[model samples]
Target: MIINTTHHNTEHKQIIADLIGSPFSLLQKFKMKGVGSKRMIIDKVSPNMQSMMNKVSDINYANIELRPKGILVMINQGLKNFTWIIPYYQLTIYKVNGSSLHAQGRFVHFKNNKTFKENKKFFDKLLDEKVRYDMLFAMPQGI
Candidate 1:
């Protein structure tokens, strides 16, 4: 399934994926957080560009979008079971390096071209970086 052709569209959208593990299977979870996650069809870029780009760490993501409600994830499938929506706040992007992302204690890496800057422009419209990004990307210091 990993080798399937990427579905591209002129429509702006960002799909988050990991190169380390099988990111395609992210919709299914081994453990439930109790909050309950939903699957929706999403194919739009984030309105707040800086809100997402500020979390960048050198490596680029397959796609990462910030929606009005939460983080909208894109899935390559039929209309019935397509997208996975994870609350933006619940998704704690703690660490991002190489092609890997440590979000909410789960390791997720990019499975597509990782040219961070170029990819960002290709996905979303870039806004200024003056916005306060501390609270969003902040992780627990230690136990």
Candidate 2:
């Protein structure tokens, strides 16, 4: 399951526990630490999905070296099964400009071409060709 929490309130904690079993377990494995903040988690994914994440990580590191902006792309596979293939994804861009940090993100159902195209355009404009190309091919359809 994928979990996106903007607040680490009581309700949020309870929900996370119910969904994932134990917060401490996640923390132990991922070595994550946050008292109160927004968090996004991908509980489990297929090997293919894990490979895509590695590609995104590589792109993120490369972009950091070349530009002030960096983008992280991820596919979230939920716990429930889908009759047809479902591609739920999110992209987040983090920019550093002379001591200031800025970020923008979008979540989309990957079957939507319009949304996918829009995101591709934004990333192409903000990132390098290599990063864009990697992202394009990382999709399940290999677009």
Candidate 3:
């Protein structure tokens, strides 16, 4: 899944539309299971999935031609036989010339029925000094 801090807008929507037009691609659907909030689910209907996809679609569409800038904090793991159980997180900041103005969020390598909170502490710590410092320090001055 793709994640970005930018608000979902028209430009981003176009990018998603293009990706959806491609073959052998699937879009994730967000559904509300309870009163808490909505969560993403894999959708089998191709066109419908593409049409409904948001967030990531918006991010990619908006910055389709932009080169990656700033620092990207990525957490990845390789699970041998059980590849699906691996958990990964990536946060990317897209810069405009000299300053960061866009960001994307991602989570992958999750197994079926897996829960994020199971690794919340680890994820939180990464978001804290470890990941935060890395991103901030890696950026060029004025970015």
Candidate 4:
């Protein structure tokens, strides 16, 4: 689900929380080592998500924040902010030419630039979280 979070909206907050679980407590965040990624330059986005990017700007930037059961991909457009909520089961990430995050038929590609290199550890942490979440539903070996 994508929401315009430039302003504080109670309904939006509730929806996001229900979709991906709530934000982690300070202690949880501390144990996770960190739950956010450094800013990254966006290289491209799925055609359906073109509107979320600023066409006028040559470069777009985004960052990711880890949630208990999912992750939030936050895109900035001038003064406006858009967030894409992706649960662990629905999220797909790839690192071909650069980093690509896809969910709900939309995707955003982050350039493999300096900023992306700086976020290597964060990406690893995200994958680990996803694996942990998925294990909760693992089937029995003989089932």
Q: Write the per-residue lDDT of candidate 4 for residues 19-101, one digit (tens) a residue.
A: 99999999999998889999999998999989888879568889999998999999998888999999999999999878999
Best by TM-score: 4
Which candidate has the top score in lDDT? Answer: 4
TM-score, cand. 3 vs. native: 0.21
TM-score versus the correct structure, for each prediction: 0.31, 0.21, 0.21, 0.96
Candidate 1, residues 1-143: lDDT per residue as tens digits? 11222445332233333312223233332221111222211212234222222232432223444333344433333222223344444444322332332334343443333244334432222111112233556677889
What stretches of model 1 exceed 4 Å from their correct place? Answer: 1-62, 77-81, 99-107, 111-117, 120-143
Comparison by lDDT, 2 against 4, better one: 4
* Candidate 2 lDDT trough over 10 residues, lowest sum: 59-68
lDDT of every model, 2 decimals: 0.32, 0.29, 0.26, 0.93
In angstroms, give how far residue 84 of model 1 lies from its true place.
Answer: 1.9
Off by over 4 Å in 3: 1-114, 130-132, 135-143
The alpha-carbon root-mean-square deviation between model 3 and the true structure, to one decimal in Å, is 17.4
Clashing pairs in 4: none
Q: Compute the lDDT for candidate 1.
A: 0.32
Q: What is the lDDT of residue 65 in candidate 3?
A: 16
